[model samples]
Target: MKKTIIFIMLVAMNFFISCGNSTNSEITTQKENEIVSNNEENSDKENDEGKEEQIIKIEDNEEDEVVISKSQAYLDRYFQLEKELEDSLAGKYSGTTIDMKEAVSIEYDSWDELLNEIYGVLQEQLSEEEMKAVREEQIQWLTIRDSKAGESANEVEGGTMEPLVYESSLAQSTKERCYELINNYMK
Candidate 1:
């Protein structure tokens, strides 16, 4: 189901981001002067009112330190879409829609065709951080796709089954286009 796939993707993303951390170490800085100045100002105000001043501390979670530029975000989105398509095609999905005809429509005759096209677009635009993220995403996507393919091989029904082809092709084509765009942007 869509929920299951979404959950799986979220878990996978979390794993990707949080790998090799003891505590969730994120970037942060202390504004000593600002805090001190605010506290001092508050203390004076409280004293005039014949009351004790209470200091307030503010904390922040600074995850996602590697901020991607707008262009890079587009690239990353493309990369993610491609991954989703690849996963679906490989039947690594647990959704209600298991249209094989649709899934197979994005069949790339060769990886080189995909890689070359993607590389052409991405080699110039993306930053090092974005490139790294895309590469990591690619690996994760491929791993999921391969596992799904293996798991679903037996369950996939065979034969021409022509009438269902239109629906199947539509689904598969959509997935392929999504991945293609992503790969193109990230490459």
Candidate 2:
């Protein structure tokens, strides 16, 4: 009877040990499945948001207009050039006026290209009346930009930093104008 009692206790312990392991494995599997499901849901949400952001809809009495987002390539190039200019000024030139002027000049070229691209888009997308209005605004903006740039340079007249400041001002104004045109007219 003693031996039988010991054997029964061992069998009970073995059953309990096996059940504990099975429960732990099931819990682990459940946690992994939950993580995978959460990841899939987050991915779906991101895709939906991306799609919504890429399209701009404008309601007009004349027609319904859809303005697609500009090509990322052009913007990417502009940003990349700006970054390169910053890096050069900070590291290689150490903020020297001459080197800064050269760097700003390169950035100005990029801004000029962006301006041309915005102009091309306007020409293709705008009605003749709208185009004429934009052209007039652009001419006025150019005058202001040139005058401001000259005044900014004059602030440091005869100084080594004058050209650098002038080019920087021009680049900044052009960039702002590009954004303004895109926001006001493109949409």
Candidate 3:
């Protein structure tokens, strides 16, 4: 049952975590670069590699290049490291239901923290009007997040796996929301 739950999570999460071409026509790329290191300018502080991955996006005009600060490379590297951490933690803490719970709980906590950071950054970075729009969207998102988490947990209601599923669901959805907030709202 636990394996089934984890498998479902991995499958569901793959959809959002995988990076593909942007829907916006304005975004283009001359070439995709290997995981380049982020500079002092626009990288996650948690990046230990001292290197940031690069995600190129050219404007439709071709002449005007658009480098979205604190996005792209940051997200790429952050997501990579995040995946590694989750896998590592899951392995480290697995065996018993208690251990699985710890791993997923940690994962959920990490994602929750990232959401807070992203939300704070957006609050500062977005304009008054844009912020208002996102603020409303965020309110709606919070409701959805709770409902989704509960629904996922209910799949195994009264079982030992219930809380584990709940936390993993929260972690997965919150992680997706982090990416959504960045890609859609972040400039």
Instruction: Find the candidate with the highest lDDT and give its number.
Output: 2
Q: Is candidate 1 or candidate 2 better by lDDT?
A: 2
User: Which portions of model 1 show Cα errors greater than 4 Å?
Assistant: 1-106, 110-112, 156-187
Tens digit per residue, CA lDDT, model 2, 1-187: 9999999999999999999999999999999999999999999999888766654333332243235545344455556756776766565346666667777887788788888987898898889999999999999999999999999999999998888889889999988887777767874
Could you tell me the lDDT of residue 21 within candidate 1? 53
Candidate 2 residue-wise lDDT at 78: 55
lDDT of each: 0.52, 0.79, 0.76
Q: Worst lDDT window (10 residues) for model 3?
A: 25-34
CA RMSD (A), model 2 = 7.4
Pairs of residues clashing in candidate 3? 36-52, 37-51, 37-52, 38-51, 38-52
Better of 1 and 3 by lDDT: 3
**Winner of 2 and 3 under lDDT:** 2
Comparing 1 and 2 on TM-score, the stronger one = 2
The local distance difference test score of model 3 is 0.76
Candidate 1, residue 66: how far the Cα is off, in Å: 26
Residue 32's C-alpha lDDT in candidate 1? 58
1-187 per-residue lDDT for model 1 (tens digits): 9999999999998987786452333221245566788999999887866532221111121222222343355566556656766765665233324455444444432333455455555656678887787678667766665555544443444634442344344344434544655545532
Candidate with maximal TM-score: 3
Model 3: residues with Cα > 4 Å off, grouped in runs: 1-67, 92-94
